[model samples]
Target: MKAISLLGVGICGGALIAAGCRKTNFVDKMAFKSAINNYYSTRQDCVWPSPVKFPVQADTSNYEQTKGYDALTDTGFLVRKAAEKKRFLIGSKQVNDYDLSDKGRSSWTAEQTQPGYGNFCFGHREVTTIDGFSPADVSDATQYSVSYHYDVAGVPGWASTVEMKTAFPGVAMDMSGQQSAVANVVKSDSGWQVNSVTPTD
Candidate 1:
């Protein structure tokens, strides 16, 4: 079984776990599932409204070696490095996902910033979680759900949150402005890399 150390999600404890039926001993851990949502975006295309402090290459001009990455631009640079090979694009279609409550959100905010993600995202209609892997594997999968987190080496902007906006027009109204999308991730030398946040084709 492969093991992974989560860079984001600065919670208490040595580590967390979320195994499937094969290892059904659900602890007070966390996980993610999917659904169409109207959160974290500005465009009506299920794409995140590339934040004003969007993570990118330009932000790494003078990475204060002292701060060790304690600013918005630092984070943008890190995300850019992780996503070096991709752009926002959905890799899978089958609806599936995850999310945290206001309280949970508070938990992450209070203690951690940028809930680091290896793959899994807390909320979305298309990003699904794969189950039944080993404890290490399962935990690794759940850890991936979070997008960014503090304490994770090389990961910046650990204290940022994505605002919600919608995409996908009139086919169904009422849930306007809300947004959701499939998170595209790539395998990296260090680990998984997420780049493009694309939509269904």
Candidate 2:
């Protein structure tokens, strides 16, 4: 009778373990999807062109005024500005939602604005479709993998000569492409965050 009782306990223990795994996986999947969606949404916003504003008088001496005018005509400047805003959404070692000190922002801004850094600029990004999430092979609950398919258009900057000749005139270049990728999501103490995005083969 004791042997039979031991066997029953073993079976119950195995079932409990399976149940726990299923529950953890379910939660992780949900958290991973949420993080991906948030990241995508912010990326879309980042490419949106800010309203065009040109200074009444060019002020090269004033950095702020000069930067504003440059954004109107220089695609690189706009790209860097948008990148700065996006950094706020995706917290980095230096910049996070909790502590967005001016110092942190300034660091990223300077990086983006570095000379010859911007080769391409995007006017807007529209996500045509997003595929369902897929599980990734990882050992821990804190890390999750997901796959997605998306179509995006990188509108060339206002400065593109090709864009200037558009039928509408002064319109940006339309550069569209499709992408499929796998992304890793990490669960931090604060919440789920996207660790990195990699293109899938």
Find the number of clashing residue pairs for candidate 2.
Answer: 0
**Each model's C-alpha lDDT?**
0.27, 0.45
Q: Write the per-residue lDDT of candidate 2 for residues 1-201, one digit (tens) a residue.
A: 999999999999899987774533334455555676667665532222332221134334445444433443333232221111223667532211121223323322222444422222234333344454544343366666667654444443343444233322223222324556677777788788888888663
The residue pairs found clashing in candidate 2 are none
RMSD of each: 24.3, 16.5
RMSD of 2: 16.5
- Would you estimate the TM-scores of all the predictions? 0.17, 0.36
Over all chains combined, what TM-score does candidate 1 have? Answer: 0.17
Tens-digit lDDT track of model 1 for 72-176: 223332222321222358452221112333332332322133234211112223222232222334433432322311111111223223211111122112122
Candidate 1 lDDT for residue 120: 12
- lDDT of model 1 at position 80: 20
Q: RMSD in angstroms, candidate 1?
A: 24.3
